[model samples]
Target: MSGRVMPGHTSDLLTLQDAGALWAGLTADSAVPTASTILISSLGSAQMSYALLGSHVVMAVKAHDGRWSISESEVRRAAVGLRAVKVDPQDLVRIGPFGGMPKGEHSEAVLLGWRRRIVGELQRPDPPEQVVPDGDDRALHLAGIDWRRILTEQSRDRTRQTWWLPRAVVRLLDAAEHVERRWLQAGQKESKAAEGIRPRSPRSQTHTTENLQVTKPDHLAASLRPYNEELKGLLYSVLSRKPDTSRKVTGWICTLCRKVPATVLDHCHEHGYVRAPLCQSCNAQERPDHLYPNDIRVTDRYTRLLTTHATEWLRHWHRCPGCRTRTTLPLSHLAAWTAYVACRPLRPTHRDNHSSRGRKPCGTLRVAWTGSHHTPHTCQLTVTIDLCPSGEHRDLAKVPYRQATEQFRIWLAKTAPTVAAAAGPDRLDDLPAQFRPVIPDKSDKGLGLF
Candidate 1:
């Protein structure tokens, strides 16, 4: 007895493993799903219903667009005085996120029947939630579990960038350090009983260290290391102090940002000479000699070097070829480089473009830097033009953002306004009191303000 099989894609097909028919899906149609179905409008719209089958009764429990859940009180009330109540052991369950927000949504709609004898018996909590992992903390969570090891491994492979958002035991580290500082101030006055109780990082031993130490990977040559004598000597030799140059003769990182903990070596595209260490944010913003594919202003040797750099840069951000102003994105992000070369102007799509889904949906090819210069935040689609046809019309290619936005944005902002504001305020409005329209000015001119 397969119930409504996941609504709109309803079919008679049901695999034995996938069939959990405890709680069937509810559809939005006005008529009730079945005579047994009960409506719970207080929860939301009558999009779902509960069924009171013989031996037990299960009610609708979903709360939002996401999953079905009820308050703890509600669940307790439903449990009542019945004994041995639950979804079937064979029933496939899992509606809510496990371990997050105590309420779990079943993978399928499941109805728990309440029989009228002792009232009801409590259902066993989902089985897997009870299992504890071997040698893991009781409070281990998705946001922090294995992140330290993961970050350390990532830093090893990608030596150029090592910055990661740290989210583990930050407050603990601070409190531990404060206790140690107080112990140091106490000096000999402290009792021997308090000797070894000073809290330290789990990874640290005799000498205290940071919870997660940011260290240089082993493969990096000593010359590229921030504090190396070789790097220091080189900086002292060629470093000139200009108004823009913030680095002093004594400091190690005098590059793009004096702070921000630079981890990679910055080198010149033309000479291939190492300049200084720069932070990850500064490293990516380094403009290569060649701005675009066939840029003529840059030297051939430098352009060739930069072209190689762009290929291995990892990110697929590109500038508009036509206007050479704002950046552009490919219609198909998977093949961004190929799409940019083929499409002169990436076509723009409004929100309503499901009909064109045989092709990738695209909006303004150009995204501009809004609050910060490092990353672009705004995708301005006001000037984009849809030059190509859709999949039904024979799949069309993307266009360059320069062609889409430049002329159109300018016309809408500057040129198009000329038609509306061509003639200034009327001459009568500009006139003084004595030069204002007299009562006998003209028969067509009305005298009253009304």
Candidate 2:
């Protein structure tokens, strides 16, 4: 249903159902969680903040980047007054921040079930996330290191960061060109000044690149490709730990950020090219080098960067849905207006990004599974006709698993030849495409979302 404009807030509109749910949630719970979509400015820089009503406001899906301001009222009159005169969800802030409902289309019962879940959670709040797990004792510990927060998505509660690879706990597999630049420049300085201290390299997992070597806490140790093998395995363990979560080793800095503890082992997925240690944020935005062919556009920096690959691995892994003859999603996203219709269930998640496109989302990510979270999953959904983000007809829903894979195969056959024809057979710079990694039989269970 189309939204009806609320009387007081000129910029905001509330759909009838959303208003009803907000009213019900507030009246019953005696509190309503703040919408991260709504924001108020302040002088302070705290990430977890709360503030009073202000004219300058916006909404969003905040990672650990912003503070949360949940408003609560003592007067019983405020709740009854809201029912008489409509109020937007933002008015109820002061209790806690909420990321809205579970995604995907569901029957009314599912909505009811989640509402109940919300009530149960509010009645008895979740325990503090800082409790240390067993077997985590260390002679030396990094102060303020919360393994649970580091391993999980600190952005929004729902972003779901950790995934399981065959041999690693993969929180992220992304790029950090800017950070890398800063790191390399710093290494050059370290190399020049510390020439007197040069010695044989302490053994590392990946090959250590720089000539100068030093002991713990040196910025170059974590940045170098080869790392100490024994520490490397222990280093990798921090990302994968769920129940027995442990704090990071002392002086192991993130290779990318140069600040914060390194939790992820940033390795190449296809080649198993183990890179250096990275904090969660530093590696969140890089396209894995193995995804595409090195081309003319890349040779000359005129073409747009491969930012999309770092954002959505599955989209590139399975290949983008069709947009007539094209695969680039921007082409598909634009094509949606003319060639596709929006699905009600696939509506974008709400956020007030101070723009008209606040409700926009790229596409949903899905994984097909057979047993439970404990068991391995197998499937063949390679591609689909959903070239546009608005098109909900993914490979899984539109075609049989085998047929979808075949269609993908056919597309690859046609596309690869076309690319080769353009590049010419003699071109030496182009790299072969990297296939998705193989899953091992006894791998750690990834997040259910993965």
Candidate 3:
């Protein structure tokens, strides 16, 4: 069967019986058909279906029946009316804007009412004025015409401007009018020239380059290798305990500065090197020596010192004794070192910075058991060794448990007396809630005396 009709061909006629026969044949073999051909049959069926099912069934059936003749002229007339309907109704509607349809059917009623009113208005008045008003002279001049003359000529041709004019005829008339206008304009120019007045030429046109070339700097730093290698090497030398004598090393240095201690011999031991080679003072103060290779320590002594004195031990690097070189370390190094020490297994709780059981040192040993506890229990012990304020527990490892406990008692006694003197008798009872000292009565004598 034929496909849908092309838009302009919508008014073509065909019989429903022929359309149905065509569709049955087309669909029989699952074959594709041309759009135009298929549409002929499709539209025929649609018209028949609409007739069978529409609200005004009897009228639809009569319209679709071939027995009822539908003239081409009548169809053409209907189509022309539809086209005219699309134009603004002000020209056809004689009524003022205020005279419109009632609320519910405003759109359709307004249009119908306007057409009727226009016919009435036209009959009552003299043929509508076609002359351009004097005020519209400037408008006509801007449009490249003499408005008054054009209006006078158009008024004479008003009878020719019929609603029944075909679109093709309208276009032809428009083209002819345009040519006539041009002829008139040329005549005007010639008259001006005859009077020795030259017409102005159109404005000169100019074009400029849209894209301008940009030049970039010739020398720009490309890679970080040159800037970071020295510091990275220094850090590796210190952490790995290997002297930086131009010897090959293997391990990951701090990715930022590419530095690790010498102690980290190769990649195999790289994971253990926590602190970057640059010291805290260097990172904080931004001094060159902070990146120097020789200034950093490779021995475990540095770690022990840090563990003991913490940040205080780091402050000492601000001045070097060996050459009195004002040493500076990276702040990152201090932070990294603290983190490493916290994670190390040297504390009594067997916890590190990564674990909740770890304690921040407060000038006292805080211990807890991992095993289950039964009755209330307490134990007495002693510790004795040199200790730095850095909280590094190095001395505790060296002294026996009993001796360490005894020294701790003695130290607490001497300090408590001074503290009590300053804070009053309540100072003795104000020990940390987490722990209780079990010193003999002799040690107690120093408690409240102040």
Best by TM-score: 2
Residue 317 lDDT, candidate 3, scale 0-100? 33
lDDT of each: 0.25, 0.27, 0.24
lDDT of each residue in 245-321, candidate 2, tens digit only? 22332134555445445544444333222345444444433221111121000111101112222222222221211
Supply candidate 2's per-residue lDDT for 51. Answer: 17
**Counted clashes in each candidate structure:** 26, 26, 55
Show the lowest summed lDDT stretch of 10 residues, model 3. 51-60
Query: How accurate locally is residue 398 in candidate 3, as Cα lDDT from 0 to 100?
Result: 28
Q: Which model, 1 or 3, shows the larger TM-score?
A: 1
Q: What TM-score does candidate 2 get on C-alpha atoms?
A: 0.23
Candidate 3 per-residue C-alpha lDDT over 162-201 given as tens digits, one digit per residue, 9 for 90 to 100: 1122222222222222222222333344445534754333
Error of 1 at 325 (Å): 21
In model 2, what is the error at residue 340, expressed in angstroms? 16
In TM-score terms, candidate 1 sits at 0.20
Largest lDDT belongs to which candidate?
A: 2
Candidate 1, superposed: residue stretches over 4 Å from native: 1-251, 280-450
